[model samples]
Target: MAGPLTSLKVLDFSTLLPGPYATMMLADMGAEVLRVEAPDRVDLTKVMPPFDGKISTAFSYLTRSKRTLALNLKQAEAVDKVKELVRDYDIVVEQFRPGVMDRLGIGYETLKAINPRLIYCAITGYGQTGPYRDRAGHDINYLSIAGVSSHCGRADSGPPPLGIQVADVAGGSHHAVMGILAAVIERQQTGAGQFVDISMTDAAFALNAMAGAASLAGGQEQQPESALLNGGSFYDYYQTRDQRWLSIGSLEPQFSARLCDTLGLSELKSLALSQKPEDQQRLKTALKDKVAEKTLVEWQEIFADQDACVEPVLTITEAAEHPQLKARGMVIEVDRGDGVMQRQIGNPIIFGVKT
Candidate 1:
């Protein structure tokens, strides 16, 4: 509890990944987060199997360093208890559908009235308004609706299902944390807190990033495997002879030159940045063939000292054991509240302060 946000307190009323993940990050940075869960509610993370001692392994990972309380919000006493807690826990995070909190008599307006300086953040799928506001959606649905699926994966195969929950963690969780922190800064100046609206879909829609810029202003509708970075050029992944994937990101002329020369196909260096579809495809074919000739290990040894940005696509276990990641302290063991210690991925944020 020695990080930058040590003085901050949070009351978490979120169920699944987005809200819970946000609170986890806040707790990691030394915020005092009190998780208020309904005793009868079935949190997937709590009952999804793979137990760590007495608690769910996923639950153990997500709820680390946070105090927990169970309350049935249907009871007036529970609502009053929450209202009482709000006096000190000035920041509130809830993931219920819009109006559900209002109906429960513990919404932002109600709590904000008690503490005019309360920072309330609401995270939902579509948002507090719009036709899809009340409609349910998962990470894939949000990403699909946001046009992220349009230009990912092979054009013939459509978009591949990603292992990660891009919308939930990246879109909802990250954005909620950013919004809450921004609101905190604003409150410092105004001496009054405000509500933060975080819609997973809205947030995912904005993650299109440079591709979106192209479509909106350049009037270029990006297609699957059609863009420079996506998979159109040699910047994509190539399968090694052992079926292991190698990511070739030799985008710059210097890097691609090094890549072409090191692979003994220096003649292709001129075509590395070719915009013509035929030449780009040809260059890709040659690089793919050359890379496929070697096993992942063989290629790794060849490029061990190369600055070509070529690297092996590692599994999670391999990644955890990688020298660079190990040096960066990306994995650690933490107590699971039951005093049972387990290894989990460490937070990626590099904080200068000890926590």
Candidate 2:
């Protein structure tokens, strides 16, 4: 039942979200991960709210399956210690601004000199060789810079701030994991490791592939909530009679036709892909009025056996307890020692071995 990454060892010097999440995934896959936290600058999540008997739930979930080592890197002895450890560790994941690791004398060049097979991944807000490299930014700033924020939310209300850190987790953590794994495979063939420079901004920009493709193909920059996928068409969330939300994603021709048939609005099917703004708005209003005639649960039952892609929107709590998610084992209980059991979201990867 050993995981695929059981043979690897990782040294993690990242704090907060991105790098920690990448190493956490490695640890979940049975890699030996040593998380090094500085005494002066502890990961802020450790002190964050919602603590369980002095353990932050955020930190507990993120740092699971990893060992911790506290060290003050301001001292030369700590730098030398890391250098010694780097010789044995297979990969190193760090989240520091550009030049910070170099200033500490533990940059990629210094570590690669000691261990040529070391896979060094550096995750930053903007990359090591950009004008904004040294600029400090969080997930929101990165998303804004990548043009992702400009296309979110309704046109009338402008772009609403996202509740989740999409740029940090998707852009940084996912990309870092991908880059490190690819480097590991490449090293086996070439017998040499390489530096992975990951920028949150760059990763977020790459996520706009569909929008970027349209722009490159002579389309204008899409406005917020004005694109088909961004809520322009009839494929959107509608409020039910009970004020609860139902999501309709009948994008395909067949699905749209089925939706029209379900609602007894065959006349509206021809207006599904209407290019005229007025027609689109009229269709949206019709769909909205139709949806408002039923409660969310009623619509859920109505679409239970259909393929129109209509679904009731669930709250965060409801989502965790969803029957489909429960069947898939997306929610799991983890022991944090001392008989402390915490509920956590399970890893999405479905390897043959147990997680």
Candidate 3:
């Protein structure tokens, strides 16, 4: 099928996750993405664990639906070749530390001059400008600096970080895609291309809009595991008898009451009367005890008829085969050569066009 971005051409100069994942999304939508990698640089995804023999599972998963070209940017001839390629591309995405591109002589200033209509996006840890712009940082450091890590984990703990790389993927990758798309739309009208500077730390801070709002209103202090949506019994995960997990999100009183009814806890139905801190604590403790009475499957069956907004947690493997996922085509099998058909998460966007 002809994809929405079939006419778009992208030149990607990024290693690792953020930039590659962003371009992967575009490639899945039919954009022609060419990834530029260093010839001798090791694919970190292959070096990391959870491998399948010599195959880099991480690379295999993230790099699907795109083409790759290894080049040494330091070489003058390679730089000229890249410039020629960029002249014919619609978008250029690079994820290097600030000034790295300038030093390589392929920065936005140089590229935009070559291709006036080229949309250039730069993704970095701190951003193109700031006091910490040149400072090195990772996902954890970005989250910490953005005040996001402060709201994670239990009150007694030292604010444990989230398992996923929120700043890198959400802030960096997804944000870059959004910026590029917006720039593309604007370019269509004005016939002028511009630069997109995306900061992982700044993006992390942007994700905490709700928490920032709460702090601004003085509704509550942003404490670890203390926020309304962060910890409270009404909106958290619980363990069942079989050690399986279930997540509850009945923040509304009506939904909480429905959950209580589903659990046959008439005595504690009053617990859903208010969302006060003490009330939430009591409700959470009561629900934890009640949920522990049965296996996750039992609760799933019990709440099948209620609007309690509860769902059993599924592992990555189970999630891939979930009925809803299958129905929505959330996973797809792709042939990756070597007589292997690998399964990867499919594109989430559903275009009107059929393939």
Candidates sorted on TM-score, descending: 1, 2, 3
Q: Between the candidate structures 1 and 3, which one is better when assessed by TM-score?
A: 1
C-alpha lDDT of all candidate models, in order: 0.92, 0.90, 0.87
How does candidate 3 fare on TM-score?
A: 0.95
lDDT of 1 by residue, 1-355 (tens): 5578998999999987999999999998989999999998878899878897778878988898899999999999999999999998769999999999999999989999999999999999999999999998899999999998888899899998999999999999999999999999999999999999999998998999999999999999899889898898889999999999999999999999999999998998889978888888999999889989999999999999999999999999999999998988899899887676799988888777543
Candidate 3: regions farther than 4 A off: 217-219, 353-355
Off by over 4 Å in 2: 353-355
Clashes (candidate 3): 0
Please give, for residues 48-90, the per-residue lDDT of candidate 3 as tens digits.
7766556677888777888889889999988998899988999
Of candidate 3, the 10-residue stretch with the lowest lDDT total is: 46-55
The candidates, ranked best first by lDDT, are 1, 2, 3
